[model samples]
Target: MNFEEIKSDENNYLMHTYGRFNAALVSGKGAKAVDVNGKEYIDFTSGIGVNSLGYCDDGWVKAVTEQAGKIQHMSNLYYSPVQIETAKKLCELSGADKVLFCNSGAEANECAIKIARKYSFDKYGDGRNKILTLVNSFHGRTVTTLAATGQEVFHNFFFPFTEGFVYAQANDTDDFKAHIDESVCAVLIELIQGEGGVVPLEPEFVKTVADVCAEKDILLMVDEVQTGVSRTGQFLCCQNYGIKPNVITLAKGLAGGLPIGACLCSKELANVFTPGTHGTTFGGNPIACAAALEVLNRVSTDEFLNEVRQKGKYIIEKLSTFPNVKKTRSAGMLIGILTEKDNAKEVAAKCVERGLLVLTAKNLIRLLPPLTITYEEIDKGLEILKSVMEE
Candidate 1:
C-alpha cells in the first residue's frame, strides 16, 4: 500500500499512543530503508537496535527460514535443538551459569528482578525485597520493571507501581549510599544509560557499587537489554567496566529482529529458580532461537567487534564537527549527539525528511546504526545527518 493508505488504515485501526512519524516504511536493504513513496532513508535506528545485522541479513534469514520449515515452536516440556543451542551460545558468551528466556526487554528485566528477590528471600527471609535502581534509568514498561525505572514521569498514570523499588542518583556515590537500607535485595544498573541520553556510568562509580553490593551482600544486576548483543562494541557493556554482575538482562538485538529476551545469572543466582518457580511458553521457541543463534555467531566475532568500534569512532568524528552539535558521548556504535542550537527531537524529525532515520533520548539525538553497517553507508548517513544539523 501507499504511504497515505497505510497511514490512514493505521490511524483508523491502531491506538493513538505514539505521536506517529510521517513516514511509512515498506522495505529495506542493509542499513537503508525505503518508504512507500520510494523515499530512501539510511536507517541509523535499526529498529531501535533490534536489527543488529541490519535488514534481512542473508544468513539470518536463511537460519530463520530453515528453522521455520523444521519446527517453528515447541512446548517448554519438550526439548528443542535450536533453543538449547541458543542458550548454550548465550551462556558461553556472557559467562553466566544459566539463562531464562522470555519475550522482550521488559520480561527479561521482570525475570531478573524476580530472581534477585528470590535469591534474597531464600537467604534473608522477608523485608529484603527492595531493588535499588539508578535515577534517570529506564528498565521496561511492565509494572515491576516500570517501578524499577528511576524516572518520575513514568511513575504517574499507573497508580501504586510495584512498591519494592527505591531510586538512587546515577553516578552519585553519596546519593547512592544514602538510599540503601537493610531491606535492599539488589542494586540494578545500566553500564551506559541508553535511554537516559546515552550517559556512560563512571567507572569509579561502578566499582564502588560493585564493592557495596559485595559488602552488603546485595545482588548486582546489569540491564544490558539495550547495550548487549554487540551494540556497544562489546558482547556486553559490563565488559567495558571490567565487572561481573550477578544478573544481566539481554534483549533487543539478541534475536536479529525477532522477539527474544534472556535473563542470565551468575552461579549464585542461577539455582534460585527451580523448575516450577517460573517459566514462559514462548521463551525459547525454535525459530526465534535459530535467528538469535545466527546473530550470536556473527556478532561475537573478533573482526566484527573491531569494526563496530571503528564505525562508532567514525560516526562520532563526523558528528563532533556538525554545525550545532556540542559534543557526543558513547563507547561504541551507541551514540548520543548533544546539539547546542536545535532540539534533538527536531533534528531527528529533519533527518527523516532528509532520508535518514534516527532516535532521541531526552535532549540528545540517539543513534544506533547496525553493527554491520559499512563505511560507505556510514558516510552517507552522516552526510544526511550533517545537513539536518546545519539546517
Candidate 2:
C-alpha cells in the first residue's frame, strides 16, 4: 500500500497509541529500510532494538521459515524440542539454571516478580512481597510492570496499579538501603536505565546492591529487556559487572525481531516456579524459538560481542567529535546522544526527512542499531545525524 493509504487505514482501524513518524516503512534489509513511497532510510532504531541481526538476516530468516514449515506453534502441554534447544542454549550462554518462556518483556518481568515473591513466601510466608526498583527505571508497559517502573509519568492513567513496589533513587546507596527491609522480597533493576535517558548505574552502587541482596537473600532481579542478547558487549550486562543476579528477565532482541520473553533464574530459585504456577499458550512458539536459537548462536560469540563493543566505541567517539554533540552515553550498542542544543526531537524529525530513522528518550536522541550493522551504515547514519544536528 501507498504511504497515504497505509496512514489512512491505520488511523481508521488501529488504536492511536504510537505518535508515529510521517514515513511508512514497507521493507528493509541489513540496516536499510524503504518506505512505501520508495524513500530509503538508514535504520538506527532497529525496531527499538528488536532487529538484532538487522532486517531479514539470512540465517535467521531461514531458521524461522524452516520452523514455520514444520511446526509454527504448539501448546505448552506438548514437548517442544525447539524450545528445549533454545532454553539450553540460553542457559549455556547466561549461566542460568533454567528459563521460563513468555511472549513479551512485560510477561518476563511478571514472571520474575512472581518467582521472587514465591521464593520469599515459601520461606518468610507473605508480607515480604515488596519489590524495590530504582527511580527513573522503566520496566515495561503492563499495569503490573508499570507499577514496577520508577518513573511517575507512566503511573498515571493506570488506576490502582499493582501494589508492593517501592522506588529508590538510582546510584544512591543510602536511598536504596533505606527502601530495603524485611518485607522486600526482591530488588529489580535495569543496570542501564534504557528509557530513563540511557543512564548507566554507578558500578560501585550496583556492587553494593548485589552484595546486600546476597546477604539478605533478597532476589536480585536484573531486567535485561533492552540490554540483553549481546546488546551490551557481553552475553548479559550482569556479566560485564561480574555479578550473577538471582533472576534475569530478557526480551526485545531475544528472538531476532520475533516476540519472545524469557525469565531465567539461578539454581536456588530454578524450581520455585512449578508447572501450574505460571504459563502462556504462545510462550515457546517453535518459530520464535528457532529464530532465537539462530540469534544466540550468532551473537553469543567472543568475536561478535567484541565487535559490538568496538563498534559502540567507534560510534561514541564519532559522536563526541560532532560540534553539536554535548556528550554521549552507551553500554555496547545502546546509545544516547545529548546534543548541545535543546532540539533532540526536532533533530530527529529532520533526520527522518533526510532518510534516517532514529528515536528519542526525553531530550536525548537514542540509537539502538542492529548488532550486525556495518561500519558503512554507521557512518551514513552518523552523517545524517550530524547534518540534522547542524541544522
Candidate 3:
C-alpha cells in the first residue's frame, strides 16, 4: 500500500499512542532502508536498538526459520530444548546463575521487581519491599514498571501507581544514602541512562552504590534493557564498571529483532523465583529463543565486541568535529549528541528528510546504529547528519 493509504488506515484502526515519523519504511537490508516511495535512508536508530544485527541478518534468519519449521511454540508446561539452550548461553555469558524469560523489557523488569520484593519478604518479611531507583531513569510503560521509573513526567495520567518505590538522585552518593534504610529491599539503576539522554553514571558513584548495597545486604539491580546484549561493547555494561549486580534485566537487542525478555539473577537470588511463584505464556517461545541464541553466539565474542567499541569511537570522534555539535556522550553504539542549539527534534526531522533516520532524546540527537553496520554505512549516515546540522 501507499504511504498515505497506510497512514489513513492506521488512523482509522489503530490507537494514536505513538508520535510517529512520516516515513513508511517498506524494506531494508543491513543499515539501509527503503520507504514506500523508494527513498533510501540510513537507519541509525536500528528500530530503537532492536535490530542489533540490522535488517534480515542471515544467521538470525536461519536460526529463526529453522526453529519455526520445527516448533514455533510450546507451552511452558512442557520442556523446550531451545529454551533451555538459550538460558544456558545467557547464564554462561552473563555470569548469572538462572534466567526467567518474558516477552519485553517491561516484563523483565517486572519480574526483577517481584524477585527482589519477594526475596526480601521471604526472609525479612514486610516493610522491606521498597525499591529505590535513580532519578531520570525509565523502566517501562507498565503500571508497575512506570512507578519503578524515577521520572516524574511518566507518573502522571496513571493514578495510584504501585507503591514501595522511592527516587534517589543519580550519581549522588549522599543523596542515595539519605534515601536508603531498612525499608529498602533493592536499588535499581541503569549504568547508562539511554532514554534519559544517554547519560553515563560516574564510576565512583556506581562503586559506592554497589558497596553500600553489599554492606546493607540490599539487592543491587541493573536495568540493562537498552545497554545489554553487547550494545555497550560488553556482554553487560556492569562489566565495564567492574561490579556484579544481584539481578539484571535484558531485552531489545537480545533476540536480534524478535520479542524476548530475560531477568537474570546471581547465585544469591537465583532460586528466589519458585516454579509456581512466576510465569508467562510466551516467556520462552522456541522461535524467539532460537533467534536469541543466534544473537548471543554472534555478539558474545571478543572480536565483535571490540569492533563495536571501535565503531562507537569513530562515530563519537566524527560527531565531535561537526560545527553544530556541542558535545557527545556515549558508551559503544549507544550515543547522544548535544547540539549547540536546542533543536534536536527539528534536526532529527530534517535528517529524515535528507535520507537518514535518527532519534531525539530530550534535547539531544540519539543514535543506536546496528552493531554490524559497516564503516561505509556509518560514513554515509554521518554525512547526512552533518549536512542537516550545517543547515
Q: Rate the local accuracy (lDDT) of all candidates.
A: 0.91, 0.94, 0.95
* C-alpha RMSD values across all candidates: 0.9, 0.8, 0.7
Clashing pairs in 3: none
lDDT of 2 by residue, 171-190 (tens): 99999999999999999999
> Which runs in model 2 stand beyond 4 Å of their true positions?
none
lDDT of 1 by residue, 165-263 (tens): 999988899999998889999999999999999999999999999999999999999999999999988899999889999999999999989999999
Per-residue error at 197 for model 3, in Å? 0.5
Alpha-carbon deviation at 3 in model 2, angstroms: 1.3
lDDT of 3 by residue, 61-162 (tens): 899999999999889999999999999999999999999999999999999999999999999997889999999999999999999999999999989899
Q: Whose lDDT is greatest here?
A: 3
In model 1, which range of ten residues has the least summed lDDT? 313-322
Error of 1 at 152 (Å): 0.6
lDDT of 2 at 318: 90
- Those runs of model 3 whose alpha carbons end farther than 4 Å from true positions after fitting are none
